[model samples]
Every structure is written in C-alpha cells, then in structure tokens.
Target chain A: MRFVLVAGTTETAHIEGISAAGADPALMAHTPSADLEIVEYGQPVQAPVMPVSPTGCPTPAVITRAVHELTEFEILALDAGLVRPTSAPTVALEAMPGRDIRHPRPVDSAADTFEAARQLGRSLPDDELVIGETIPGGTTTALGVLTALGERAVVSSSLPENPLALKREVVDEALAASNLSAGETADEPVKTVRHVGDPVLAAVAGMTIGATTTDTSVTLAGGTQLVAAAALARHAGVDTALSVATTSFIADDETVRMNELANDLSLDVTVTDPGFHHRNHSAMNPYIAGEAKEGVGMGGALALADRAGISMADVREQVVAVYDRLVVDESL
Target chain B: MRFVLVAGTTETAHIEGISAAGADPALMAHTPSADLEIVEYGQPVQAPVMPVSPTGCPTPAVITRAVHELTEFEILALDAGLVRPTSAPTVALEAMPGRDIRHPRPVDSAADTFEAARQLGRSLPDDELVIGETIPGGTTTALGVLTALGERAVVSSSLPENPLALKREVVDEALAASNLSAGETADEPVKTVRHVGDPVLAAVAGMTIGATTTDTSVTLAGGTQLVAAAALARHAGVDTALSVATTSFIADDETVRMNELANDLSLDVTVTDPGFHHRNHSAMNPYIAGEAKEGVGMGGALALADRAGISMADVREQVVAVYDRLVVDESL
Candidate 1:
C-alpha cells in the first residue's frame, strides 16, 4: 500500500467565510503546502504557520502522520499546485494555482496536470493507492464540478454550519460566467475542471482513472471533494472499481449526500470514526464540535491504523503527541 | 522493482568534444531531458530533436524503452536539472543545472537536492530500486569529484576514443579554481559535489544513502558516473551494501577502472552485454564499433530482461522496432 497526498491551491479559498481549513482566509493559500510538509517532516519547514481551522483545530494531517508513523507505509507527496513552497520532497506536476472560481478557466493547467498525473498513476509500483488532498474551499469547487456534471451535490464544509447557500451561489455565478449549464461538460471531464474546479480535482481524477488501467485499486481519501473526483472519472468513461475512504463526519453530514454520490458513481464508501470525543485534548475539541470535518485523508489513515491492529486510543495518543510536538512546541 | 532515471545537465557539456551523448555540443544540453522522455513515452515530446551521437548513433534510451515495453516495470524520471523541458511526466526536484566545472561552485543546489532526493528514497514503495542517470559530460564531472575525493579515477566516455587528457585538464583546472587539494572535501561529500560534481551525482548518492535506512537495495545503473556516486556515498560514511550495474562495453573499456572503483567502494558490480554486434541493423553497427557504449539504464534494463527469460535477440528486435517507430519513422 502507498499513500499519495496531492496538494493544490485555489484562490476561491480566499473568499471570506467560504473556508475554515485555515486560521485566516489569507492562510488558506499556505494550507495545502503546510499540510503535506507536516505529514512528511512532522512540521512545516517552509513557513511558521501551521494548517489549522478557524477555531484553532489542527489539520487532519496530524492524524495521517500518526497513522504513517504506526504503519510505516510509503508516502508520496504530489504537487498539483501550491501557493507556497514546501521543504519536504514532492513530485511537482508544474500546475498553476487555480484562479477564483468565478473565472471561467480557473485551472489553466487542468488538461496538462491531468495528463501528467495520469502518467504518474500508471507508474506507481503498488497494488493499492490511497490518494488524499488538501485544498481549502475545495468542497465548494467540488460542488461546482458535480453540478457541472449534472449532479445536485450538497458538499460538506469544514465549518460547523455547512455554507450551502454561499457555495451554491458561487457555483451558479461560476457556471454563468462560463456559460455552462448542468451536464454541459459531462462529456468533457478535463474541461469541466478547467471551467469551474481547482487543479487538485483534475489531478486526483486523472490519477484514479489511470490507476484503473492497472491492477492498482484506488481509495479516494477525502470528503465530498473526492466524490467530485469520482464523478469526473466516471464521466471520463472509466468504470473500474474504486472505493471512497472518508470520515464519518462526511458520511453523516446532513447537508451532503455522500452515499448517494458514491452510489451514482458506483463507488464503495468506507467511513471511519477516530473517536476524538473520548480524547480530552483541547486541540481535538473542534472535531468533536464538527467545526472541521475531514481533509488530508484522516479517515483513510484511521482505517489503515485499524487494519494494522492499532486502536483508536493509540492513534489519538499519537495525534496529541504530534500536535504537542509540532503545533504547541513549535509555537514556543 | 522500480527504475528511476535521474536527468541533469552541466554547462561543461557545451564544451566541444567534451560529450558525445548528443549529435552536437549544443544538443548535449537536451540529451538528458530527451533521453528520459524517450524512455517514458517512446519518443521526445519536448522538441523535434532526438539524442544521438556525433556519428548518428541512437541514444541507449531506445534500448531502455524496448526493455520497458517487454517487461513492464514502473519507471520514474527525476529532474535533477534539465536545460530542456520534457513533456513526459517527471518528479521535479527543482535543482539548478551545474555550472562549468571551472567555477568554484558548480552545482548550487547540491545540498538541497540531495536532501530532497534522500527523503524520496526513504518513501519509495519498492524493495529494489534501479537508479540510472542521463547527464551529458557527467563522466568528466565524475572525474572531477573522484579527483577531489583523492581517487586515482579513470572514467568512461561515450565517444569511442577516450578523451582522457582533456577530462584530466578540465578536472585539474576545476580543482585549481576551487583552491582545493585531493581529498580536501572527502568528509563533506555534498560540498565535494557543490565544488565540482554535477547535480545527478548528488541526487544518486543522496538517494542511495537514504534507501540504506530501509530494506530496499539500490543498484546504481550506469558506468563510471555511478561509480562516482558510490564513492560519494562511501566518503559520506554509508556502510550499507550497494551494487553497480553497467554494460560490458564499460567493463571492457581499457581507459576506465570499473572493477577497481567498484572493488574500492566494496560494491558488487554486474555487467550486461546486449550483444549488439550480432544484429545486422545499421543502427546496431555503432555498438559493434564501440561508439555510445552504454547509457539511459540500458545495462540495467537488459539485466532485467535477461532475468525475465528474454533473449538478447528478442531485445534487439524490439530495439529496432522502437528505433523505427520513434526515431527513423518519426524523423520522416
């Protein structure tokens, strides 16, 4: 098994109150780079800022890192687009950071990045690939992609209150700007991402589609954002078996229809609960409050840990240790 | 098993008569990029030019491509430094091309690239890694690194006639410009590469050292240039077992001390013969004449093919087919 974390950025994340994946809207651009760096190096080496929710919850990379330390699975970082540089080694696909979602062509490198990632998918030397993503405001972009593909997608938000109206308005305006109707781009998956989606969606979709050509079984590791990738792959004419690994938060989100989306795409969905409420860590309180649901493959990591016979208590302990070491100690 | 081909370049290759990996001195800058592109995509997508020796001898990438078509091993291209861009997907390490060896600091990104490659090495999923390199004028840089490390090194050349005196003169001048004596930078292997060696050497050495921390065994796949990487790893105090894979042409070259260098570094060496002389094709005549003996992981690819029960005749037939499809036919 191999863990591939695809990191990218979108200026749509800059929209105020649209994303909670970073401490501030200005920090959203840096979140993807920081998340992957923290996963690889235990801390961010490129910047002083760590990826945290608006309510001060640590990014799910803490959970991913804990699982990696326990299972010792090979991890690879792929740079679809990054607003900031990371000191951790990454496979750069030379993609440009996405513009605001209202821009007709937000991800100018969509086709190229997809082709590049598809080539990468074909060459991964593993039977199983768990692909995760870290892109602030990605759920909104996921809604845009799913809507463009003719799905009435209700995406999960990192915030306690899902910003359904705000995401739908943004997608509507984006579609109007691109002169696209629902299902207009169903036949052109790459063009769909280029019009209204971020670079990470195109990359993840391309990787999944490419992996289907081989013996590798792909696990899309995220929330509604990865569901958008599954839709993109499905529209691209790939019928290979794929599964979705996501947090119970996403599976249980009243605003999102994860099961319906997975069923529509013929994807088996696995939801993992990390039992964070039982842990008395202040840093994990936001997760308990549903302020930050899932990103950075938290659910997939937890499932791997479970399969490796590591208890949730052990994972939670390691997560706290990582948080203390990387977040608390580093701040000092 | 996975094959990683590290591609880089140096301004030293621009020096006339310094390298024969390309058709002309100017073309040398594109050889590394083009070679890997051919190996991955069966042809160069970046430019119309294909890598060929001054005598129109095709690059060894054709052989690697042929073997890859036969035995489907995951092949990855890592960009250490590329003067020309390749359309093929590659893991970009953001390394700068090495300056002329006459400069005191030839490869400025040596330390950073080495560290990045080291991280990548530690995360590779495969238990066995075959690391090859395609860098024009790399043998001369290898000699520079070898001399700086106090080794009485004899390096191989792509040209039939070994340019020993010219390579020595360049290395000697490089040492003089750096104001360093033999073995002065032995304790600082990264510094040794920074002063005189190319980025590919540092990348290969760093990857080898990093892989030593795991169960993966690394095979340095090339000739004298790889020997330089072995020596770099050795001087860096890495005691883990490593091996060298090269062609019979390099092993038989009287001007190169392949066995001596491997023995000194305690690295097991494997030499493969593709039996190009037995083929009747005009392109195969170059091998018969000992021009462009080995490169682009041809030796390692051949060894893998042999292990898979593939005969040399089958490999030669595929080579001709690839040449006809990619080189001969594409040119027309």
Candidate 2:
C-alpha cells in the first residue's frame, strides 16, 4: 500500500489568466508555498485555506497531504517546469520553463524533457507508483495535448460551474494559434506535446513509459490533465498498464466527461469518494456543488488512503481539520 | 533485486587537491557527465574516463559503471552538494556548495541537506537502496567527520601510495581551525560536517538516516567518506540497518584500513571484487596498482551487480569496452 507521489508544476497555469482553474486566485497566489507546507507539516497548511480555487475550494495537494498522514505515502516533488524552487527535496527533470501554451508551442523542450523523463523511467523499479501533478492552467494544456493527439476532449475545470465558455474560447484560440488538427497525432505525439502540452504531462508520459517497462503498475493522478497524459503514454505504446485515478467530483462533472476520456484511451479509472457532503467543513461544501472539483492529486491521494485502510469519514474529518487550521480564524 | 543509484558530487572533493585522490585530473573534471554515461551506456563512459585519480588509477565509479551494465540495477542520481549541473535527472538536495575544509566549516548546509535527505529517505519505499557519492576531496572531510565523531582512524585515498601526510596535514588544520575536539558529536555531528566534512558526506549521512528510518536495507558505498557517514549516522542512532559496501581494490590497499574503520563503527562491510587484473584492459591496471581507489557509486554498484549474478569477467569486459570507447580510442 506504500507509494511515491511525484508532484510537479507548469508556469502555463499562471499565464492563462486565473479563471482557467477553479483554485482561488488567492490560493493560487500561495502556490509557491505548497511544497514548503508539505515539507513542514504532514499536510499542506499555508495559511488562508491552503491552495483553494478562486471559489474558496481547496487544491488536491491538501488531500495528498492528509493521505500522507494516514498512510505515510512517499512523496517526491518533480520540478518539470516550475517557476520557483520547491521547499522540499525535488527530483529535477530539468525541463525548460514552459512557454505560453497560447502560442502553439507551450513546451519547446518536450523532446529533451521526454528523453530525460524516459531515462528516469528506465531507472525506477516497477513497484506500483502513483504520479500526480498540480498545474493551475493544466486543463487547457491538457485539452491542447489531447487535441493534438487526435482526440477532442471536454476538459473539466476547478470552477464548479465549469467555465466552459472561457475554456472553449481559449481552446479555440489555442487551436487557431497552433494550427493543429485532430487525428494528426499518429506520428507526432512528442511534437503535439511540444506544441500544446506542459512539461509535467511530458514527464508523466516519460515516467509512465519507464515505470511500465519494468512491470511497475502506474496510476496517473488528477483529472483531465492525467487523462491527456495517459493518451500520450498510450500513443507512445507504453501505457497498457496505466490507470487514471481521480475524485468523484471530477468523474461526475458533466464538463470533463472524465470517464469518457478514460474510455477514449482504453485506460482503467479509479474515482475516490471523499463524501464531503457528510463532513462539517463549509470550506469543502463547494466540492459537492462541483466548484474547484479536482487538481493537485486529491483524487489519487484519496484512493491511495483508502487502499491503505483509511475511511471516507477519516479523510473528511482530517481534511476539515486541515481546512479549519488553514482557513478558519484567518487572523491567527 | 532492483535498486536506484543516487550519484552526485561535492566541491569538497576538488578542494582537497588533485593529489588527494587517485583520479586523473583530466578524467575527474568530467564527473558531471558520469550520470549521462550511465543513462546512455548503462555504465559511466563520460567521453573521457569518468573518474580516474591523480595517480592515473581507476576509481570505484569506473568499476561501478562496468558492474551496472551487467546488473542493470535501477539508478537515480541524487545531487547532494554539487558544483555543477548534472547532465541527467537528479533528486537535488539543493545543498549549498562546499567551502574549503581549510576553513572552520567546509559545508554550511549540512543540517539543511540532512533534513532534505531524511525527507528523501521518507519518500523512497523501504525497498533496498544503494546510496553512493563522488566528492573529489571527500577524504579530508571524512577525516574531519570521523575525527569529530571520536574516531582517529586513518583515511584512504584515490592515490595508490595514499597521501597520508598531506591528508593528515589538512585534517589537523581543519580540526585546529574549527576548534573542534574528539567525541564532540553529541551536539555537533551535523556541525562537524559543516566545519570539516563535505556535502556529499553530509548527504550520505542524512540519506542513510532517512533510508534506514523506513526499514529499508541501505548500503553506504565508497571508502573513507562513507565510513565517516556511517559513523555519524550511528552516532545519531539511525544506522542500525546500515552496511558499508566497497571494492576490494580499496579494501586490499594497505594504505586504507577500511576494514578496521568499519569494525570501529561496528558496521557490517561487504567488499566486492571486480577481478580487474585478470582482464586485458590496461586502463584497469591502475586499480590493481591501488590508484583512484574509490568514488562514485562503484563500491555499491559492484556489490549489487555481484548479487545480480554478474561474473567478474562480465564486469571487466564491459569496463574495458567502456575504457576503449571513451579513453583508448580517443579519435573515434
């Protein structure tokens, strides 16, 4: 039941103008401290409610942290294209800082990054590993990577109401900007990632390939972002053992159609139910309403916690305590 | 039987002078590319020999690389306190580069690096791990650490003749400069490293503490440097499951009482013989001559490779081939 959590980021999240993700701009602003919190506390508690979406919703990193408390999950922060240094020890994939995905080539170093990631993959044992990510504007880039990989996916967002129009607008602009067409990825998977995907996805693809080659089971954590990464790994022909693990929040979101995305790529999916509605934390209420559903690996963390024998109630109570510590009595 | 090799360097290695080690000055300069060689050829073949010492002798890294090709053990490069960027994926402990041991403090970031290493240890599954390092002037620091921990043991060298006088001179200067006394490690293990040890040794100590915390069997690879780290970890009471693994070239050398050093620490030692003399590679003749004694992950890599059933002949041929490719036929 033990696992390693590879956390990473992409600058493209901040470039897409805040609304692309459900995490609150305030929380997003505090994203720099996420690794610090993880290093200091068993869970992330960077004051003012951790990394919540714009709607006061929490980031999945909190869930990942809480799961660590329950299961002592091994966590490794992977610096794929981050804007800052992580407070925690990090396995640097040494990716070039991501370019604006809006320009049709968000990650020019995709090939080099992939090579490094694949080499990294070649080194890790195939023990079951769950790789997760936290990129603010990741979904838009996911849409880009997916689109380039010949799939038109309906991506979910952090905003509960699902900023579909805004996402669609960006998608349109990104498509027009990149001049990429659907069904054109048969021979250009790496190129597609270079043009539209972020560094995290590319590293994930490379890690998945590397992990699977040694018979290690892999679970891609997060929602649409991982769904897209799964497709790339599969396209690279090393993803038969890959599974996408997310939360019911993302699974039930009509906007993301997460299940459909998984099916599109013939991947297995695991959706953990945190039962936030049964909890006492109002900070979590937005989740039931579908706002800021999933991002920072909450889905995978919850699933892993459950696998380690933690109950949904335990997860809810612990998460509420974290919310209270981080959100309540802001003056403290 | 698969494991990850966390390799990195510390500026301390270079500070001890080119004569402090047996690695050729030319080959030693390319240490940063050793991981690249591991990634490309499954052993180190860094365009030039990765780590020959001042005496024109081969190092344990060369042997480690040859062993890796036969064993195919999983590897991960961990950057403890390196002077340059490694040309491969690395788990950066992000330690401050080392200062000269001639000053009171050699590594200022020992505690911080140790904390990071412990976190790294917490994150890797208690699965078996072989942690190795390559700090150019590490022996002097090892002397500092060992001395600080109350052990006035003799230190080994990359030089066949063992530059004991020069090393003792430096150690005496470092101890006097730091105003540190023997057995002062109750509150100064980390500081001892800071004042006289290198980041690689500190990281090795930290990583050993962290790795052993999770019940994972750990093998500290190399000669005196690792011996010092083992002492610090033991002094801290976190090295119960730790073992020191090294090469016979280092062990058989009359210069380094490596066995007695291990015995003093009450730690188990496993010395793997690569049987290089039976082979035709003149490049390896230096090892039998007792030059470039050990560094990189060679000691541990050799042990693990043997465990994986690789014959000494297999290791020799592979090493010779690498030497031929990277050293002998320079035109090609």
Candidate 3:
C-alpha cells in the first residue's frame, strides 16, 4: 500500500544552548526541505537554501522527497509549529506559530490542535499513514515526554556522538518547568504536552489517534518522537495496530537503548537496512556519521519504497541525486 | 450540504492609514471569530473577541455559528494565514504567515498554497462542499482582483458606509506595484491573486478548482472575496457545477452594484436572508447597519439551514441566544 508522511516541528530546538536537532542548531527551522526539494527538483534554488545538518548532510526530507518521486507515494508536510515557514505545499495542522518550549506551558491549545489533527487523520483516504517529524531539539522533547511517562529514555540525534548529557539536562529542565513530577505527568498525555512537549508531539499524537481510530495502519516513522506519540495513543486506548519503522542506524545506536525503550513503551519496532555503507555517494556518509539519524520520514519512506519493490540501490541513488542537486549544485 | 469555513488573513488589513476592513480596522487581524464562534456557539471569548462591526453588531461569524449549531452540518476551520493563532482546531492551508499587501506581492506562494487547498478540497468526504472565507480588509483586495479581472466591482463592507475612494486608491497602488493593467491580469487568476489578492483568495480559489476538478458540488461562500475565487475557477476552466451563496446584505446592498458585478463576472449567486430585522438582540444591529455584511461562512450556513427546513426565526433566536452568551456569560 502507498503511504503518506506527516511533517511537524517544535520550538524546543531553538533553546538558547541546545543542538539536539543537528550540529548547527539555528538551521533547525529550515527543516522542511521536502517542500522546496520536491518543487525545485532538477532545478536551481535561489535565496533561501535547503537546510544543512552540522555534518554537511542535507535534510532527511530529501530522502522522503526521493521516495515520493520514485514511488509516487503521497507526502504531506504538516506545520506543527516552525520558526520558519515551509515553502512546500503543506497540510497545515493549524497548530499556528512555532512554540518556544522554554515556557512552563509550551502548548496552551494542545487539546484543540490535537482535535484538528485527529480530524485531518480521520478524513484521509484509507492508505496506510506513515507519520514522521522534523522538529530540531525534538528528541529532547521526546525524551522529556518519555521520561515524564516514567521510562528512562535516550534518543539518537543529528550529532554523530549523541549529546546524552545535554539531552538529560534539558529533559530535567523541561520537567522542572512544567512544575510537575514525571510520575504525575505520565498518565496525562495532553497535560504532558502542554507543560513540556512541543506542538509537533501533540499534533503527531493527535494525527495517530485520528488515523488509528479510523483503523488505518500507522507507522510512526521516526525515533523517540513517534514513541512519545505511541505512548499517548496507547494511553488513550487507540486499538489500531501501530509500528515504528526506522533505519538500522537508529536501531544500532550504541548510546540509545531503543529495544528497551520500545519494549517498555509497548511499541512494535521495524528496522530497515538501507545498506548506506555499501552505497557510493559521500552524501550517505553524514547519515552513517549519524548526523540527522532519521527525520522527515526517511526511515518510513525507505520502508515504503522497499515494500513497493524499489531497491535499496534505487533509494540510495535517488538520495544521492537529490543530495547532489541540493548540496553540490546548491539547488533545492 | 455540510460546510467548511476556511479563514485566512493578509497584512493588508494591518496597513497603516487604511480602514477598509471595519471601523476599528486594527482589530481586523483578529478575524478568526469564524473559527471560534462556529465552534463554540453562543459564547464569550477572551484575548481576542469576536469581531464587531462599527455599529456594534457582532461579526457575521455569529450568524454562521448560530446556523452551524442549529443544523449539525460538519464544519472544518481552515487557516490560510492569521496574525493571531486560532483558538479553534483548524486545517491549516500553511500559506506562510500573513503577508503585507502593501509590498505589492503579498502572496508570493499563491500557486503552491492554491494547490494545497485544491488537494484538501479533493480529499473531503463525498458531502457537498460549502467553502467560506474570512479575511479582514479582504473586500478591498476583492475589489482589486475583481477590477483587475475586468469587472467594475463594488463590494460591500463591514462599515455601514463604503470606503470607495480609499479602496480605489489602494487598488491603483496595487496595480502600479504589480506592474500590470486590468486587462493584462484577466486570464491569469493566480497572478491576479499574487498581485492584488490575499491568502484567502488564493486558498479559496484553489479549493474551488480542486473540488470542481473532481466534480464535487461546491458552494463558494461569503461575499466579494468568493467572487474573486469564482472568477479564478472560471478562468481556470473548471467545469464543475459552481455557485456562490451569500447573505442578502451582500446581494441587496444598494450602495454596491453586486448584481451587475455578478453578471459581469459570469458567476451564479444565491442569497440567504436570516431575517435579522425580526431578531431582538442588540448585537445583531451591526449586520443590519451594513457592518460585516458577510464573513466566516455565515451566508452559506444560513442557506444550508434554510434548505434543511430551519426557519429564519429559529436561526435568529439561536443567534440572539449566542449574542447573550457572548455578551453576558463570555463562555468562549
């Protein structure tokens, strides 16, 4: 079955001293590269450039854009909240402006935005929905949400060496900011999001509930963020089958306890082997170096392409081509 | 016959020295009363209250809200662009943040935003679509686009008296900025919107095309702003059955030759009167005074209710009740 990827963001990425999204934290807002990449594919981009991870790799949205071009999978860019506006034609979840999570109440209208996303989910065609997120510093929020739910969680990141220290510290600050003990926040997902989580978490979680409530198979297509959404869905008693599809890179991140986190969260995990190691492009190197491990539905796009009988080689070639267009020629 | 009121904004409303939207044109930016009002019928709002015309009648959103509550038609709130975030859950069209039309090219991404709206239009359930728009200062932009499209358009206003001189001057300025003549922009609706229209115009026009392309029975809701959308749909060769449903205030405004404009534009128009004169609430006075002649899908909502066997008195009573809730209890 074809898949649709929902993209969202969070302001937690732009915290004064956090780089959880990528090496250069400021570029986190330009994350919706899929919008421009798809529109200007095979063309030159001027003015604003495609966002680059600190490691010199393009956005994971390139991966999703390539898959869309190759397999014709319908893709959706959802603005949960972004510091910068997406040029891509997006299904605005109408979460409004990018939110700063530094505030005690990060998302005041969490319930309302979630209802909107849920309605959007229920309205979609029955195609399997592969939801993804690209909020910079989002994993920190994810870690915050998961930890609030009482699981010791570590998530991979755009940085080659995961910043476990900073992530933990931020999670601690988030919990403190909420003025709620982690245990108290665990059973209240909506409250959890309002206190510490960003708009993306609430939107994705709501989208999951909407889609799953309608019995659509949903692949939470990223790492810890999806897990946070799954936790919310599970808490809300959503019975639709849900799974996490990611690259082996995320699965094999030595610093992260993915298996334990998944098991603790009761989320099904599916890992795809893109075999980037065997690929010829230097563009794939940053991915292996672990900058932007998985985002913008990269893992899920790869999985869908694979399911459609598209090869890893084909996926790699498309990624490399998009990378060359974006990085080499500097065209979006 | 369910309806979706897609609300958006343009910085054009916030333009200095222009009061084309309403008496207190500065409040034009907070025009999402359609969103919150339609959602919470008969309620008071905080921070941002429902827009009130100079005559002190509430925004037409009150009319739409009363109808929506009276008839259980499914409603969707769409965000094209807004200076303030909508308190209600909304399907965001993600047309970047509100742009100042004073810049001459307010909606640079008009084509893409339209495509997104069109896609959204195509994805709705098989129910007949009634699309409405709410953009403060939108009437002037409507005048600009309509005039550019070769129609001697005179649109109604939120003020009891029309501001024809200032509107014409601004339209002239917009034409000069876009470097286009009235005849030159006639065949190009997207260009017309990008040049002189707001995000609401592009989004609603795109929605019309999308639904019409898919052969969905579509009703263009609201006033002259929707006329611009109909003009775009017609210019684009959309063969779907298209009609506009508006309030009697819009059709019978003696000051504005709406009938001549409609005939000149080759568009079908349907007018619904909620018989607001019989209503007892002082809040409904602004509408009768020619303030906020149409907005937030109020006209279409009333027409749909009237068709569904609801009486004008019933609609008016609901409206009066909501006015009391908003003015007295403030429950939003």
Best by the TM-score measure: 1
Model 1 misplaced regions, further than 4 Å? A1-7, A11-78, A83-94, A98-136, A142-163, A169-197, A201-332
Q: What is the TM-score of chain A in candidate 3?
A: 0.91
Comparison by lDDT, 2 against 3, better one: 3
State interface RMSD in Å for all models.
7.8, 7.7, 11.5
lDDT per residue (tens digit) for residues A129-226 in model 2: 78777666777778877877777567887765666676666666776777866656655768878877788888888878877887778888878888
lDDT of 3 by residue, B154-269 (tens): 77766677777777788888888878777578888888888888888888888788777667788888877787778777777776567788899988788677677667656678
lDDT (10s digit) by residue, model 2, range B127-243: 777777766666777877787778855788766677777777777777788887666764567887888787777777887887778777788877787888888888777737578
DockQ scores for all predicted structures: 0.09, 0.10, 0.03
Cα lDDT listed for each candidate: 0.85, 0.67, 0.71
Docking model 3 quality class = incorrect
Give per-residue CA lDDT, model 1, range B57-112, as digits (tens): 99999999999988877676788988786645466775899999899899989999
For candidate 1, write residues A1-332 as lDDT tens digits. Answer: 87888899999888777899888877777888889867866777555577888778889888898888777766777888888866555667758899988997899999999998887787654689999999988999999999999976678999999989998999999999899987799889999999999999999999898888886899998889999998999999988888999988787788888888888889999998888889778667788888778888887888888889999899889888888887664667
RMSD values for the candidates in order, in angstroms, are 8.0, 9.2, 12.3
Rank by lDDT, highest first: 1, 3, 2
| Shift of residue B27 alpha carbon in model 1, Å | 2.6
